[model samples]
Target: MSNLDSKLPELMRQATEDLEPESVDLVERSVAQGTRLRQRRSVLAGTAAGVAVLATLGVVVGAVQHFDRDGQAAPAGSLAVGPSATPKPSLPSKAPSGPVATSPSANLKDPTLTTLKSLLQGPSRTFSMPENWGGKDDGFFGASWVVDDGKGGSRVEVLLERFKGPARCAGEPGCRTRPDGSTIRSESLSPEYSDARQKEFGIVSSHVEITRKDGRRISVASYNGVSEKGTKHTRVAPILTVAQLTKLADSQAWQFPAKVSK
Candidate 1:
């Protein structure tokens, strides 16, 4: 053998002379330590996941408890509260059933009222005067009647006054001058309201006004409702038509007393 080959065994013995020998349990200890580390990491991960689940459950239970204490609930995502927090539904109100208010002079008696009721009588029709009239002492007299036919009830009002001359037809619809030197104005299913009450009631009227040559004026109005105000509409249209109102206004029974006939 060569000299270097002969010295190799001594060199190896010198290199290992200060080193400790390998332990028989070294590989087993290494395997057990690695397994323990892996299990610990798995347990930590499982604990974090369980904490998240418990946190979510706590939030849900807290929200439900809060709602139980109060009628209103906090908004969660897009979820809304129940109807217990909302206003209750209400039914529509009915119109008043009391008599209509009027001027203090409404109770005054006028001889002219007697004649007007007689003119309104007809088959299947009944008429009654309400405490809603005035102008008995003045030259003008106004009165109203609640008339009912077999179909429904309606209000028919009449006003007898004095006019300066034949009405100027400007802006007045269906106005015409009769051959008797009288002017007549008629409206068909037209709205005429003097105050908020009449407007709120949605009153529509069929009206006729006549200005005679004798300087006396007659106004006849029919309403779709039982009264001009404080009532709902009982029919689709007024009880009397334009033609019927015109005929009523043209009657001779609307005259005042002889002294005030001017």
Candidate 2:
């Protein structure tokens, strides 16, 4: 017998040993269905091959058109002729126009304005003056300036205070009081304007405010990405200081309104 015929009995024996009785019957039905499906697919493939051969011959005969040396069709002109050229691509449409208005402050490029924007946008923390009603440990409004070093590091905060007192150190032991009953302390940051000494730092932006109970308004001037010496990258400091002084001088909150000398 041929090799397939010889293996058929062994294959049947293995299948009977490996599969359950119900599974063996199911597999026999599946083999019969698969054989029918393969025969149908072969018949369909033959029909498609014959149709493709006929269609190719029809296209070859139909597409042939006689043309003169000038590329013009012959007198018969049976075949459909395509246009000589294709259309060009179109451009995008233009946007609609509207009225243009000038900015209210055309001088936004002013050095002072630019410096103020930089200070406000700098990486710094918010600061406010501590409330003072004679009951608080320090009878002064406090302000803090936060600075960030270039590297990933902790921020340095510089605290400033303004109060109704002399140059005495209140936090120090055995500190003396002023003649007017107020404590002797380091003179206010801006001593000339006692009424709004705290508000001196508000020049960079009008939005800054001082609302503590001591009637002392505190303002803050902050710098960022600075060194410990406060000298390197010092451009931001002087600008912020000058702006705060200017704002304090211009504010209505000052006790003695003084003109900015510079």
Candidate 3:
């Protein structure tokens, strides 16, 4: 008892000597540390949510830039400068002012008697001068021909002379105006020759008279007889019809006589 009691006192004394009051408040420190940890966790969560929102906005902007109004992908150079940009307008072209030019006719040049003869219808043709016409004395241009086309011989004549007034029918009917302001008078004449032989032969004539736009008169006549005042007729009708005589009168082959100034 004495040994045990003495060791117990010494152990109690040593334990009491080592024991002291705590410098910090343990419960308050624990609460403060927990509050700081909660604040750090809230900051990290907010940062992650902000980064996710930024990534989603970037994806939307990229998609809008790649597409066009029709929702299709845009070509390189065909893209618009901006969403609200407008396109430019186009303009129209101009037209010409003056009248178009045209080529002159070959018939406008001078023509020869051979050229006239070539225009005649017959295979075998013979030309003759009715008189000393187309001279400075008469100032006329004319020719007569006997054309035989295997049917019979017939007389054809053409005459050109200066005329002053507007064309008239002179009581003979069937006068008409052509498109180019020329006038035409066409007729068929009964036998009026006084020659007994011509009367016996029974002559007929087709006559065409044309007044040109320049006031020149052209007369074309065809006879069933060999000549207008000749003896014999070889055809029932004139070799040239009234239509043919009109065409021959209308030809530009004749050289126009120069105007004589008074």
Clashes of each: 0, 5, 0
Q: Model 2 residue 113 lDDT?
A: 27
Looking at model 3, which ten-residue stretch has the lowest summed lDDT?
A: 89-98
Q: What would the per-residue lDDT of candidate 2 be over residues 1-262, giving only the tens digit for each residue?
A: 5999999999999878865565657878899999999999999999999999989966764554333434565434366476554432111110111122111322444332233234444454332221111112433222122223333221121112334423333465423444534322121122112234213422111112232333233333333223222223322222244345334323443231112111
Candidate 1 wrongly placed segments (more than 4 Å): 1-109, 165-173, 192-202, 258-262
lDDT by residue for model 3 over 1-262, one digit each (tens)?
A: 8999879988999889976747567768889999999999999899989989998987876666666445765644465444443321110100111122111221222233344566784556554432212433555555555677767777776666765666544554466777888878767754634445445767777777788877777777788877655356777888889888778878777666645423
TM-score of candidate 1 on Cα atoms, chains taken together: 0.52
Which ten residues in a row are the worst by lDDT in model 1? 88-97
In angstroms, how far off is 204's CA in candidate 3? 1.0
Runs with alpha carbons beyond 4 Å of true place in candidate 3: 1-115, 121-132, 168-172, 194-199, 258-262
**How does candidate 3 fare on TM-score?**
0.49
Q: For candidate 2, what is the lDDT?
A: 0.34
How far is 8's C-alpha from truth in model 3 (Å)? 99
Per-candidate TM-scores read 0.52, 0.19, 0.49
Cα lDDT, all candidates? 0.67, 0.34, 0.62
Give candidate 2 regions above 4 Å deviation. Answer: 1-135, 145-231, 234-241, 248-262
Instruction: Check candidate 1 and list the clashing pairs.
Output: none
Please, what's the RMSD in Å of model 3? 32.9
lDDT value for model 1: 0.67
